[model samples]
Target chain A: MSLVEALRVSVTALATHKLRSLLTVLGIVIGISSVVSLMSIGQGSQERVLSRITAMGTNLLYVRPGASSEGRVRGAQGGAASLTLEDATALADPVNVPSVAAVAPQVQTFAQVVAAGQNVNTQIIGVTPDYQYVRNSPVADGDFISDRDVEARSMVVVLGATVADNLFQGGSPLGESVKINNRQFRVVGVLKRMGGTGFGLQDDVVLAPITTVQSRIMAQRTAQGGRTVSSINVQLAKGAKTEQATGEIAAILRQRHRLTGSDDFTITSQEETIAAQKEVTGTFTTFLGIIAGISLLVAGIGIMNIMLVSVAERTREIGIRKAVGAKRRDILMQFLMEATVLSLFGGGVGLLGGWGVSRFISGRTFSGQVLYTVVPPHILILAVAVAVATGLFFGIYPAARAARLNPIAALRYE
Target chain B: MITFSNVVKVYKMGSIEVPVLRGVSCTISKGEMVAIMGPSGSGKSTLMNIMGCLDQPTSGTYQLEGQEITRLKDDDLAGIRNKKIGFVFQTFNLLPWASALGNVELPLIYGGGVQRRRRALEALERVGVAHRARHRPSEISGGEQQRVAIARALVNNPSLILADEPTGNLDSRSSEEIVAIFRGLNREEGITIVLVTHERSIAENARRILHFRDGLFEGEEVMA
Candidate 1:
């Protein structure tokens, strides 16, 4: 029989029993939709992480005070000490390491800010004049801290956009005074609103000089220094070798701390931080995909069950066709076509359903600007191919049964 | 023309071997309207199945139109059945889901022609049911359904028309109408016909009759 005629027959059969056909195809629909939606969410999350990481300067590096004890015990012998301001001074002295640009020593603490009876909890960061350049922090209102501010141990601050909004009610906060735990500090600048970086809201912060925050605010003490800094930000000189600059900085910090074998500090580049984040997100998405795959397997089994039923119901029809001159191959083709059409229709509906679900979830979870990434063309094609393949795989036994039927007995069947 | 020499058909049920046709030999010439009459379990249906290419005798040399059909493979036999034989069944056997036209068109679907719709319509017209082409089998009366079945048989233009109790389910008037249609096809179109029936009145219309008993032909008769 011609393929067109075969297709027409299959469609007619399905149309005759609309409810049964739909129920049979529902398995395929669920399988395809689960796979598509899960993959879309995975892709969307990955893109979100990538864009956030890229927004932080590609060349930026962070040097922490202690080594990453990812696999080490808490009481291990190589555990490092807290970093200090003296180490930052040594790294910033370009005479010893010409390949190094600006170095900003940082100290962080959570504090409550109060202005005109309005209060909000915010992160306080202590840094130097070049912190903006190295960290790619853009100030929207007033200027950032100056060299004189650090030299004089000034109690002035720069508020991130979120902090400024919370404290000043959308009014300019620069040159105004805000109390941090009842200690008054003048606002020198207001940072631009940087949206969430997937870690948290980047705009909810206050910045001050390292010396001012150390001596006047946190007063966190180190064993050998006036005060301690949590981390140090470093920028490499243009066209300078990164390995050489790292080595110089490490050697300088080791000398300043008088350490041997195990160093008292850790140095990380932006690449390392981005890689770590990607590893976490990749693992999370992989776990989700595997869970979704189980649903697809169940759907495949459903297709098999329905196809077998169809073959049984059409046993006599198959025999009649054979008796009227249809080849075994022709019988096989007809049954297989029926199965494939069911699955393909199901997959088509599933694709649309998955897309709609993704859109709904994205809208509910994030700003409407957030969109779930669509499954690529290749993935959609793979889904359709899998659906068709499921039909062929499950339709085989029934087709064989039909072909093997005895024409005389089948005709006599009541 | 069909020739069957020393044909035997045996059925196996567990340890027992039930022979349906025991060494039957027969020759039927072109344009002959033959009837095979038999008591129940006399192997008449078995003979009809072998003749229609729906079954093969256990041991036989059966030739149809110069081809040794007993030796042919299943697919080759099916091809011969498509080209040379048309079947009218006792039950009318029209697909329940199909319209009258669709049922007639089924044979042509497997026959693979360019104008299946036109041929199917012409066949329905030939059976005198062209007006009910769109009516499904369930919607039509038993007589009309048999006419539709006959249209399906005639659509492929097979040389031999095999009717297995074609009028068994119809009223007397409808049965007379069916027998008249068969006689017209055989006499006017020179089509060969073989009918199986238990009714003596139906058998009387055939030009030749073969009577069967206990899996063998017991007698033969020719009518004027």
Candidate 2:
């Protein structure tokens, strides 16, 4: 029989048992749908990470003290106290590092902040006056710390938007005094509302001049002779390669610390770490997609089982067609086509279902940022291809069995 | 043209052989109308199966239009059955799910083409049941069902027609109409026909009659 005729017959056969055909392909639908949805979620999360990296500034780098090799293993936060305010000042000099732009040294510590009878625990950041330009945070009301404040060690502070809201109830605290670590400081400014990078929240901290934080509050918390700062944030000049700046920064830090064997600091580009993390998430998503495809395999078996049953049920029909001069391949084609069509139908429905559900889930928001689900077009094509291949793989045995039935015996079958 | 030489058919039943045909030899020329009459278990149906290439003989030399078909492959035999022979079964074996026109189009479908429906309608018209072409087999009477089967058999324009009790399930009135149609096809279309029936009255409708007993031909009589 021609393919058109065979397909027509298969459609008719399936139409006769509509419920059975639908149930037979249900496993495929669920499998494909899960594969699509999980991949979408994975892609969307990867985008979230990428956006976070770019949002912080693609040309930015951070230098932190490496963990003290004296005994224990620690991350950059617990590293050696080799990074200092002098290293930040040295990098800022254009003669030493031409790629250097504005550099901001931070001495970060968590503290309980109180203002207007309201109390909130927040990070207390000690920064130089260049922090406004280097970190992309500027004052929204009043003024940030002046050069005179850091020069004379004035007890003045700037509150991030969230810290200002919690401690002052969204009112202006320009001329008020807030206590950090039980020490009174004058509020000079409130920073604008800013989003956090993947590292930490930007709008939940208090800022003060470097001299005041180091000499007075958090003075006991300072590690290694009280001269160490936590980290140095470096902003690259326009059109400067990060690779060139990284080498120059490392050279200057090693010279300043007088280390001949190994430097006690590590300079890392935020983009590099973000790229590595994105690769890991991509691999994890691919693994999940494969695991979800196991259901399609089970669905293939379902198709085979149903095809066998159909072959037995239509034994006499096979006999009649054979007696009318149908070759064995004709019978085989009829059954295989039926299975392929069934699976393709299931795949089409699954793609639509997965797309709809993903869109719905992505439309919701948790805190502020919108959670996203992305379904690329190629995923749809892959899902359908897998479905068709599954049908063909599972269809072979049943089609062969039907094609090999003896016409005389099959016709005799009631 | 057809010839059967020392034909034998033995079915194996797990170490035991059930012989259904025993050394039967016969010949019927082209355009001849022959009836095979035998009681149940007398090899009448087996003979029809062998003649239509549905089953192979155990030890025999059979030739249909000089093809030496006794040893043909299954697919080759299917081709011969498709192009050279038509079959009408005792049960009026029309596909109950299809309309009469659909039933008639089956052979042409297997034959492959776009002209199947048109040719099937023509065959139905030839069988005098074109008025019931759109009705399913279950919706029509047994006689019309049988006529649809006959149309299906003739749709391929085969050289031979083998009817196994085509009138067995019909009433006397319907049986008369079917027998008349068969005689007319033989006389006017010059189509060779071999019919198997237990009823002697049905056998008398043929031009020649052969009697079978105990898996062997007992006698033959020439009819007008």
For residues B92-111, write the lDDT of model 2, one tens digit per residue. 76777778998888877777
The C-alpha stretches of model 1 lying farther than 4 A from their native spots are: A67-82, A89-104, A197-200, A221-223, A235-258, A366-378
Candidate 2 CAPRI-style tier: medium
Top model by lDDT, which number?
2
**Per-model CA lDDT versus the true structure:** 0.82, 0.85
TM-score of chain B of each: 0.98, 0.98
Candidate 1: deviation at residue A213, Å?
Answer: 1.7
| Shift of residue B116 alpha carbon in model 1, Å | 0.8
Model 1, B199-220: lDDT tens digits are: 9899888999999888888889
Best by DockQ: 2
Q: DockQ of every model listed? A: 0.68, 0.69
Model 2: runs farther than 4 Å from truth? A69-77, A93-95, A98-104, A127-179, A183-203, A206-216, A220-226, A235-245, A363-371
- Per-residue alpha-carbon lDDT of model 1 for A105-143, expressed as tens digits? 788889888887799998988888988877778789898
Pick out the ten consecutive residues of candidate 1 chain A with the lowest summed lDDT: A72-81
